[model samples]
Target: MVIRVRDLVKRYGNLTALDHLDLDVQAGEIFGLLGPNGSGKTTAIHCILSLLTFEQGTIDVFDCEMTPDAYELKQNIGVVMQNVAVFDELTVYDNIDYFCGLYISDKAKRKQLVQEAIDLVALNDFVKFYPKKLSGGLLRRLNIACGIAHQPRLIIMDEPTVAVDPQSRNNILEGIKKLNQAGATILYTSHYMEEVEQICSRIMILDKGRVIRTGTKEELKATISLGEKITIEVENLPSHILENIKTNPHIATFDYDDHVLVARFIRGENGLVDLLELMNSSHLQLGRVYSELPTLNDVFLELTGKELRD
Candidate 1:
């Protein structure tokens, strides 16, 4: 394991931030740690990096016990937090070079690494631009470049795509894949389900400082009571067709509103075919039909109730 967190616990006076959380991340895999706001995602990260002192348990990085002053281990780890940490006064090149210099002291090697990070984030054109001059997306890219410029083997990115343009989001995701391909193990945390689904090889969803589910996306989905969700749009959904779909054993629940029939199937082998056949036999004109498998969001909602968790 590249990172192992066992029985990890953190407390802030009376509130428990991490409730004996157990986590493991393998080498060369993009692992996603997903949760809602204040679900202990940040706490777990802080504990792992030794930034905040945890109440109990052990955190191991690079197959050894981690320490706050583990400079050798820290050198191999790169962290890009949710907040932008680059200096507003510094240009893009300077920001990246400064962070890279922390790990690599040799001027010749540091220059090459810094330039590579700039190229990786596609910031070549904006190397001289300060943070204030850049758009939200460009600023995010620069933040990433600063973190990964040192070419750390382990990269931890916390909500790196928050409030960024779609194009920059795509660039960041692609850059992450390239980094993993080049042998960097990444721990990515985000509230965006699709981003985690797109990039992570394995996912762990937490709620209220505890892990609810952890597995490959397929594995996690298999554990849930939700299967495929079929959506069909029609000119007008008849009451009979809606009732029939709702009454079907394969389907768990259905919603009909504004000429759209949405059926959620908890379990079934041929849900798609069965749904289509029923709709066609009932003389319901299907304008658009889409069948989607259970997503990471569904799994999270299932494990943690829809009720709000602080």
Candidate 2:
């Protein structure tokens, strides 16, 4: 395993941040850690990285004991936190080169690594620009470049895509894939469920300092009662058509309002075909139709109730 966290515990005085949380991240896998606001995800990561002194627990990284003083182990880890950590005074190239230099001492090798980092984030055009001059998306790219410039064996990224434009988000996601392909294990944390589903090889959802669920996207979805959710826009939904829904065992429930018919279905045969056939026989005009499978958000919502967080 790349990271093995066993019976981890952390506390802020009496308030427990992590409750004996146990986690395992396999080597070379893009592992995703997901949670709502204040869910101990960050606390767990800090504990793993030896940045925070936890109340109890042991974290093993790359088969070695991990601690704040484990410089050799620390040298192989790269971290890009939620907030950008690059220096405002340094230009883009210097920011990346400086971070990379922390691990690499040779000047010739550091220059090549810095250029590779710039190309990895596609920040070649902004090499001389200070961080303040770059757009939010470009700044985020620079943050990533600085972290990964050392070419560490393991990388931890927290909300790297947050607040960026769609194009930059795609670029970051693609770059993450390429990094994994190049033989680096990644620990990814994000509030964006779609991005997690897109890149994470395996996922663990944390809540209130404990793991609520852990599995692949399909496996997690299978644990829930939800299945496909279908929506059809109809000019006039026949009265009997709504009534006949009770007879269809495949369909779990439905709602009709504003000329839109939304149906949630149990896992079974195609509900769309059945709905269309029934509506056609009823002589109802279907304006538009959309069918969607259960998503990571559905799995997340099912496990964690829809309640506002601080």
Q: Cα lDDT of all candidates, in order?
A: 0.89, 0.88
C-alpha positional error of residue 212 in candidate 2 after TM-score superposition, expressed in Å: 1.2
TM-score against truth, every candidate: 0.95, 0.96
Q: Clash pairs of candidate 2?
A: none
| Superposition TM-score, candidate 2 onto the true structure | 0.96
Q: Write the per-residue lDDT of candidate 2 for residues 151-270, one digit (tens) a residue.
A: 999999988988999999999999999999999999998867888899999998888898888888788889878779999999867677888986788887789999998888986546
- In candidate 1 the C-alpha lDDT for residue 240 amounts to 80
lDDT per residue as tens, model 1, 20-66: 99999999999999888888888888889999998899999999889
Worst 10 residues of 2 by lDDT: 301-310
- The regions of model 1 sitting more than 4 angstroms off are 307-310
Identify the candidate with maximal TM-score: 2
